[model samples]
Target: MSPVIETNGLVKRYGRFTAVDHVNLSVEKGEVFGLLGPNGSGKTTTILLLLGLTEPTEGEVRVNGLDPLRQPLAVKSRVGYLPDQVGFYDAMTARENLAYTARLAGLRGTDAAGRIITALSRVRLADVADKRVGTFSRGMRQRLGLAEVILKNADIAILDEPTGGLDPQATQELLELIGSLAHEGMTIVLSSHLLSMVQAVCHRVALFNRGRIGLTGRVSDLTSAVLGGAYEVEVEASGADVPAVLGGAEHVTGIAVAGPGLWRVDADADVRPQIARRIVEAGGALKNMSIRRTTLDEVYVRYFQETKNQQEKKDAEAA
Candidate 1:
């Protein structure tokens, strides 16, 4: 099947500066895709291009099999967007806000009312339906924004920083709702700086840096590819010589003293047995040890830094 969303050689520029470089992307139907980056990294620009909010400087975009640039209205009708800064009329009630959107989306009377009620309930905002948006909290407003999307019955949902600024409880609830929506067959494009939330809901992610896509793939696949054959071990040994003891352990690549009696070791594989033996033989009492896979944050940081270093090297060479 063709992609639900596809962009080829996508580029966007402002005056002399390019905000979005050539980015080729394909998001399959029913998949929860994530766009991860810091501020000014062009994630939002890509979304705008896809929604026809802004025209691309070059290349082509297709959403649900139609060109967004050529068929803006059709594309907009099928795509629902919730930006990082979601806005609602302060004087309007939650239901009123969504009702207005429903009418704009072409639903009216009993049909619109039914969808409005269902949408509010889906986001767990039914109790506050009649309450004014001015009285609602940030999380409540965010959920109400989601209800507006549901009322539109959009085939594709685009969310930018959906959980930004929410408390722990609210974040968890919102993330769960996002997951449920994908399960119900909506193609989702989630743009977020929150790594843990992306790790939880996104089946795949593209890392944006300096207007370019530096990494893109399944989260686990990206981790394995970037952190090949690496493992982090935390050992608590009761001796100042802990690092010295594990320095010569099998497959041990690097070791650092995290704190008193705490050491972090990196190796090609499970070197715990060798590490344990080395520490014991060196007369250091081992308190505890644990090993785990490298995290997404670690891989993300390393990728951008490595790319930056490589670019600097090229600039030096050109000079």
Candidate 2:
């Protein structure tokens, strides 16, 4: 099946500055795809281009087989967008805000009214239906924004930084809501810098660095088997001799000193038995030895940093 969202050599520029450079992205139907990046890393720009909020300087983008630039209405009708920030009328009640949004999306009469109620309930905002939005706390406002988008029952939803500022409870609620929506067959694409949340909610994620699609795939796939197993070997003694002695052990690829008397050893495979014998022979006081492996954070950093370095080299050569 064709991807619900696809980009071909997508590029967006502001004068001499390229905001999004040659990004190719595809999100399959009913998949919760994540876009990960820091500020100015093209997350927002990509969203805008995909939604036709801004026309790209070069390349093309498609949503559900239609070019957004050519079929804005068709695309817009099928999409629900929760931007990085949401602004709502201070005086309008939660129910009123959703009702207005539903109308704009082409719903009318009781259908719109019922959807308004159902949407509020979905985000756990049913009890706040009568409360004015201005009086709502930051977290509540975030939920209200969510209510507005999902009320339309759009086929694809783009949630930008949906949990950026919410407290723990609110963040968990929103993440749960996103996960539930995906399970219900809505194609969800979200952008977030929060690593933990992405690992929790997204089945597939693309890491963006320096305006390019640096890495993309299932989180498990990226970190799997690649770790080959690792370990943290902490020696209470602070001496260069420890590393010198531990360095010759089989399956030991690299040793990084995290702090004084703290060292992390990367094993080619599970080699705890060999490591223990080696450390003991070195006369090292092995305070702790645990077989640990790579984490998503570590894998993400490794891939992102490598991509950044390669980009720098290319820029230098072009200059």
Candidate 3:
């Protein structure tokens, strides 16, 4: 099947500045795809282009195989968007807010009312359906925004920073709701700078850097490609030659001293046994040793750092 959303060499510019540069992205049906980057790194611009809210300076975009630029109304009818700062009438009740949205979408009467209730229930906001939005917490407001999307019965949902500023409990609830949406076969395009949350909910992610995608793939794939390993063994040992001894172990790809007597080892496979045995043989006192999968946070940092270094080297060579 064709991708629900696809962009090719997408570019958007404002005066002399390029917001999105030569971006080629594809989001499959029923999968949660994440767009991750720091603020002002082109994520929002890309979303705007995809939503037909802004015209791209160059390149192409298709939503469900239809040109968003040419068939904007069709695309808009099928795609739902929840912006970072969703707004509603302060005095309006939650259900009322969604009712207004329904009317705007051409839904009416019994059908609209039924969808509103279902949407509220899906986002777990049914109990607060009659509460004024002004009285709702930030998390509740976010859920209400999602409810509006659900009411549209959109084929795709684009959520920008959905969990931003939310507390741990709220974030978890929102993430669970997002997961359920994907499970029910809604294509989701999530944009956020929160690496951990993206890692938690996204099936695949594209890492944006300076208006371009730096990397795109699953977290584990990116971890292996950028960090040289998928497993990280953290070792806390007291010995002058700890680094040297651990470095000699087979499959040890990289090692960094996290702090005094603390070292993080990256390896392709589980090497905790090798690490423990090597430390013991080296007469090092092992305070603690643990192994776990590498995280997106680590991959993001290392990938960008490496990209920066490579660019610096190229500039130096040119000069």
Candidate 4:
């Protein structure tokens, strides 16, 4: 099947400023795909382009095999978007707010009513169905937005910062709800600043940096590939020349003392046994040693830092 969403060298610019630059991405059906970046990195702008809310300066976008630029109505009908800042009739009840949207979507009477109820129940907002939206908490508001998306019966859902400021419990609840939606066969495109949430829920992610995709892949694969499948061993030993002992060992790339008696070793593969042996051979009294896999957060930070460094070098050379 074709990708549920596809962009080819997508570019969106505001005159001299390029908000999205040569982005090529494809999101499959029934998967939670994440777009992660700091603010103003063009994550939102990319969504806009996909939705045809803003036309791209160059390249192309397609939703469900139909061009969004040419077939906007069809694309809009199949896709539901919940932006970072969602709004509702403040004085209206949750049910009322949803009803209004359902009506706008051309759903009405019993059909609309049933969908609204189901959507509210799905988000665990059924209890507050009749409560005024103005009285709802931020978390509750977020859930209401999800309910609105469900009520649309959209085949694809694009959520921007869905867990932005929610507390732990609420964040967990929202993520669980999103996962359930994916299981029900909805293609979900989630954009957020929360790395942990993205890691927990998304099947794959594209990391945006300076209006471009710096990295893209499964979180685990990206983490491994970005760090060259590296692992770190944290060793605690008394008299061990741990650094010198493992400095030139097979697969050992580098070593450094972390604290008074703690040393960290970076390796391309599993060298736990060798690390232990070298420490013991050097007559170092080993206290403890633990190997840890690289994390998505670490990979994200390193990629952006490296990209920034490269840009700085080019700037300096030109100067």
Q: Return the top candidate by lDDT.
A: 3
lDDT of 4 by residue, 1-319 (tens): 6798999999988989999999999999898999999989999999999999999999999899989889988888889999887888999999999999998788979999999999999888999999999999989999999998899999999998999889999999989999999999999999987787789899999999879999899997887677655587888898967777787899887677799999887777888899888888999888998998777778888788887899999999999
What is the C-alpha lDDT profile of model 3 across 1-319, one tens digit per residue? Answer: 6789999999999999999999999999998999999999999999999999999999999999999889988998899999987888989999999999999899999999999999999898999999999999999999999999889999999999999999999999999999998999999999999998899899999999989999999888899999999999899988647779976678999999898889989999999888888888988888898899988888989899998999999999999
Model 1 scores a TM of 0.88
**What clash count does candidate 1 reach?**
0
**How far does residue 318 in candidate 3 sit from its true spot (Å)?**
3.2
Clashing pairs in 2: none
Comparing 1 and 4 on lDDT, the stronger one: 4
Clashes of each: 0, 0, 0, 0
Instruction: Evaluate model 3: give its lDDT.
Output: 0.92
Off by over 4 Å in 1: 235-271, 277-288
Ranking by TM-score: 3, 4, 1, 2
Best by TM-score: 3
Clashing pairs in 4: none
Off by over 4 Å in 2: 224-253, 267-274, 281-284, 290-294, 307-319
Q: How well does model 1 score by local distance difference test?
A: 0.88
- Select the stronger candidate by lDDT from 1 and 2: 1
2 versus 4: better TM-score goes to: 4
